[model samples]
Target: MRVRNKPWADDLITENPQAIVLNPEHYRGQWQSRFKSVQPLHVEIGTGKGQFLIGMAVAHPEFNFVGIELQKSVLAAALKQSLPAELPNLQWVLADGQGVNDFFEPREVTQLYLNFSDPWPKTRHEKRRLTYKSFLKSYAEVLGDGGQLQFKTDNRHLFEYSIMSMTSFGLNLTELSLDLHADVAASQGELENIETEYEQKFAAKGQPIYRLVAQFPKK
Candidate 1:
């Protein structure tokens, strides 16, 4: 997901204060206030280029969507792409996923999404993976009991590692698919699956997309 440095990225981000929330921590426990209506809050970590999140926002207006991306240029791209829509239920945060607990109150988020995140394949770099136990702790705290976490990745090793990490951390796996597109095609497009830019690209190369839906353990 290499994007050419957009020279106007800073200017674009500076111009859109409402859509690109610079002070996300200030909205802790009150995320609904930013939206047109109070509803369930859904967040996507590593929300690269914004296609998946924008589509989700459009399709599920009933839920508030927040995309957190650490890369400023990438976040700016998302901001620029979302400008035309001016979606009231959508917003962007330029921050690291590790600080998720600082951005939202416990149980404030209804669901979380991880799409095509860096696998960090090396054993020594396991902690850097978004699905690592440390990251899962933040996710669980922010989501609380019965909160859902959906992860999608084309990396088989990452998917497998995530399954073990999450389950060992006491999360419950509700749904899983080794080949998501195959199921989608089998279902005749009845299954609801959003395709991210990376997802589309990987799928185009005949890669099997792995996806899983997990829930935080009940109190």
Candidate 2:
């Protein structure tokens, strides 16, 4: 997913400090202070164009949402889409996902979302996967015991790998769906799903969307 470079990307970030949080490290344990009211924090790592998170913020006002994107232009694009909404509970972060723990205190996050993250399919790049042991460890620390981790992907290999990685990390698999859209269409169960930008495109091609909801094991 190579996004076209936007010349105004830097200006968007610099101009909107309130929406795009530049110094997330300083907020760390006190993330609630950034929002209008103290509430549970839900963060989406690898948030691309911000479609899913924006919908989530609108649908669930009880929770605060933070979207973290590594690319500046992409983050700016997300900002452009999200700014008009003026969601009080939503914010954005421009940083690497690997430093998630550094930006949040232990057990600070209430939930975490990983949607269509890069698979890094090569064997040598396993460590770079979001479900890799080290990343899971950091997620566990931030989410604490019994906190939820919701993941979605169109890649079967990555989905299978994530199941193994998450379970091996002692996270309990609460739910699993091989074809989410099909299930939702058939009304197989009560699943209110929010679609990401990538999801809409991939699903349009008739590809199955894999989704899993897991929770950290209680200490």
Candidate 3:
């Protein structure tokens, strides 16, 4: 999808000094020290409109967050929102999601968030889907052993496909829920605040948002 260029893009670029990693290669194998102290780093791939990534960073001050999006226009919007908040724990990267392993060393990421990622429903486009086996392998390389992947999507087909992919990749899947809100109400401490624009829309429509948490086995 082509992203519409926004006039504010230039301003966003200037405002987000810390968000832009001019030399990501320098931090390789030394990302832990970027935080005040060593803390778990969570990454959200394809963070559209920046709502969820920003909200999570605000909510979880103890954990560092890196949000990656390939579209410059979408990333600009996120950068604008993030700059005003001056969130110390959050950073944004404009890069292909598939290249995550190249940017971080092995076992560097503690958790990953994949919220309402592209369904890529066509069989021919399965490889482009973020939950495809190839992408899972990339995530595994950066994620620590036993690190968790939290995924939520409104598309049932994509959710099912993701579950299959996770299992095929030898991940231990748990906390599967077809309806997140209903499941959350039934189980205390199960609900987290809605962070993404799609999530809010889905909730307004009373849609059943499927969610799952998968953990990589210790190697």
Candidate 4:
């Protein structure tokens, strides 16, 4: 996706103070307090265009959602989609996934969601993968006890790599599926997934979506 420079994107991000955390770093370890409720915090890294995160927020109002997007231009679209909704339980953060630990304290987040993230295919770029051990370790610092990471991707190689990485990090895998949408006929909301834009396109082309759920060690 070619993201042309959109100057207004950043302007909109700053303007939507109620829907976005313009100073996310200042809220480190204070995310729950910001929400003014004790609901579990769930974060979606690489939340492109905010579709998945927004849908989840609408579906699960009891849970607070924080979406992180690295690109301001891309995040601009997400910001546009979110601000109008005025969802009190949801907010957006513009930052790199690598710096997630800097914005949240230990046990600050109860769940992490990675949906159709970039598949850094090159072996030399293994560390760049969101599911890479280095990134998982960073996530562990912010996740609550027994916190779970939910991942979905169309790339088989990345999916397999993620499985291995989770196991190597001593995280326990609780659910595994190679074809996520196959169970749509019998879905009990879990199968009735709220897919991102990329996910819909991939599924439309008959690509199999792989999914996994891994939990961090209990405190």
Candidate 3 RMSD to the real structure: 1.7
Q: What does candidate 3's lDDT look like per residue over 3-55, in tens digits?
A: 78898887777766667654555676776656555788998998988999888
lDDT of 4: 0.87
Give the candidate order by descending TM-score: 2, 1, 4, 3
Q: Report the candidate with higher lDDT, 2 versus 4.
A: 2
TM-score of each: 0.97, 0.97, 0.92, 0.94
Candidate 2's TM-score = 0.97
- lDDT score at residue 34, model 4, on the 0-100 scale: 64
**Residue pairs that clash (backbone atoms under 3 angstroms), model 4:** none
Judging by TM-score, tell me the better candidate of 3 and 4. Answer: 4
Whole-model lDDT per candidate: 0.94, 0.94, 0.85, 0.87
**Ranking 2 against 4 by TM-score, winner:** 2
lDDT of 2 by residue, 4-60 (tens): 899999988899998988888999998988899899999999999899999999999
Each model's number of backbone clashes? 0, 0, 0, 0
Tens digits of per-residue lDDT for model 4 on 39-93? 9899999998899999999999999999998888888898898777778888888
Report model 4's TM-score to 2 decimal places.
0.94
Candidate that beats the other on lDDT, 3 or 4, i.e. the better one: 4
lDDT of 3 at 183: 77
